[model samples]
Target: MIKRKKIYIEALRILAIFLVLFQHVPAFDYYLQDTSHVMGHLFFTLIAKINVPLFLMISGSLLLNREEGYREIFRKRMIKIILAILIFNFLVYLAENQFVFDLQDYCLGVFENGIDRSYWYLYSYLGFLVMMPLLHRIAQKMTKNDFILILFIHFVFSTIEPLLQWFVPTYLGQSFEFTWAFRIPFSTIKEIFYPLMGYYIDRKIHIESIHKKTLAGLGCLSLLGILISMFFTIWIGNQEGFSDEYLELFDYVSALSAFILIKSFFVHYEAVIPAWISQKIVLLGSVTYGVYLWDPFFRKLFFDGFDQFMIPWVGGFFSSVLWCICSFLVCGILVQFLKRIPKVKSLF
Candidate 1:
């Protein structure tokens, strides 16, 4: 028998995914152009950084059950993820043009640029999923030394490689061409690190002893990570000013650290956060994958002809936020409806 702490896990998952939705819209950064405006921008950025790491860590923690073999795992996750990606892609395509099945174009486009936008991550994760069996087999023999060695390889191949390319001489550039760049997204250092962390955290770290210190640790690191990330953006921004457009290297690292610490804190304090709240988190988290797949519809709404009528920051921000929230709701609705349809339900 297994313990199902559904609410606690789900709550965080929902928070994580919706926050990702918030990131794409004007909801967070439109207001944070300068220090004088509001702290909401920095808050959003901080959350954005931590969010994916939390999601990935949770995946590592939750999916490490060895009873499921490669075939079974692929059937359960890989196919579902792919189908979900296609569903959203189709929705977005339809919403964007009021027409469907532009097979020639879609095929050529996918073959060429590789699915566009966030879907790229899905493709990358597909690669990761394929490697899971090998990873699992190696996991049995894993040690702290092995873990640190993996981290060092990640640093050399993922983090340091990029830095060296930007600064170093001729030969330092070749590592960039390696295929892991396409598959792992910064070497999946966190993915590799977190599952191993989970194994130890579950087996070694005592819940009670960690409670107070975990809270303090998460708080401090979250603050520190945000400050360092913001400093990178601000220090660079003032010289040229920060654009809320996209993320950078330091942003990813700080965000990764902040989220890891935060998740650990949450696990440490699981008993304190009321039952209702945990249920909400679990519900949202479960539905989040569907929402992710359905996001392109909302994305279409953002780029719709509404642009002609309102291009102002306030208008754009509100409209984008509305679309994103509505998209989450719509995705949830569609998923529920899809479950009732026997044919559609079978696909996932």
Candidate 2:
């Protein structure tokens, strides 16, 4: 028998999808470039950075505690993700082509990176799935303190060290490197860190705040992340011209805080939320996988023109927000229509 669904997981999934779409709403252009739009682009990109890690966290929260055997997990979960990559990548390829085939370009895209670069998450997530059993086993052996230490280590090596290396040379007139024995694995734990922490926080930590303090605190943390991102963008992005693509420590901390806050809120108040609203949230959440698959197509088809018109009228920020909302509505409807077919719907 299937286990009952968790409300917060669904809510978080919906939030993640919206943020993902928000990041994709074509905002930056030479014609639209201004201080406000540049600021908007920065804010949009910063918040949207949470989407992938949050998605992984959702998976960990729901699945890490499962009793299924590795074989079952591999067959049921890993295989499905692999199939999604193949199926969705094919659709992306077809959508990009106007009946003309470029075999060399197509092969390079599919083999080198992916059909659509955004689909790289699917591939990385496939690797995550393959490692889930090991991660689960490791997590089971870890205590709260141990996990906290892991997070600390991960932050220092993955985020702080990298940031220092990137910015220190400019400020200090020299590059700094750790002694050979003192060096840590820089980015090795990135994909696994948030997910493992998500499982730990969801299962082990029992949090409740009836006064909505958790949500308030998360809002504050998110704001702090924004400030940190702004500082870096103005300081480093200005100097470097925005080439580096590292997701910083503040982003992950803010994302984790928000993730925990939402989980706490839904856990404590799931019953108090109106059934209709809850059903709607869950319904949208159910189609997020499909939305992620089809959103780019709809964005190009519907929002491209809307963006050009709206960005000039309003600004990049609000235009993108409007585009994001339209994307959800259109993609939701599109997914619903596709779901009418039994076999085709399963691919999404």
Task: Tell me model 2's lDDT, rounded to 2 decimals.
Answer: 0.72
lDDT of 1: 0.58
lDDT of 2 by residue, 1-348 (tens): 111245677788888988887766654222125544556566666777788889988877777777667799778777777787766666677677853667687767777767877777788787777778777876676688877787788767756776787677868889787445664332245567777878877777766633576568678877886776666665665666653255364777777887878877677667778887778777888888888877766654556678779877886668878877877888788889988999777666
RMSD of 2: 3.5
The model with the greatest TM-score is 2
Residue 72 lDDT in model 2?
Answer: 90
TM-score of each: 0.74, 0.86
Q: How many backbone clashes does candidate 1 have?
A: 7
User: Which residue runs does candidate 2 get wrong by more than 4 Å?
Assistant: 1-5, 28-32, 36-40, 102-105, 177-188, 209-219, 239-247, 300-303
Q: Where does the lowest 10-residue lDDT sum fall in candidate 1?
A: 1-10
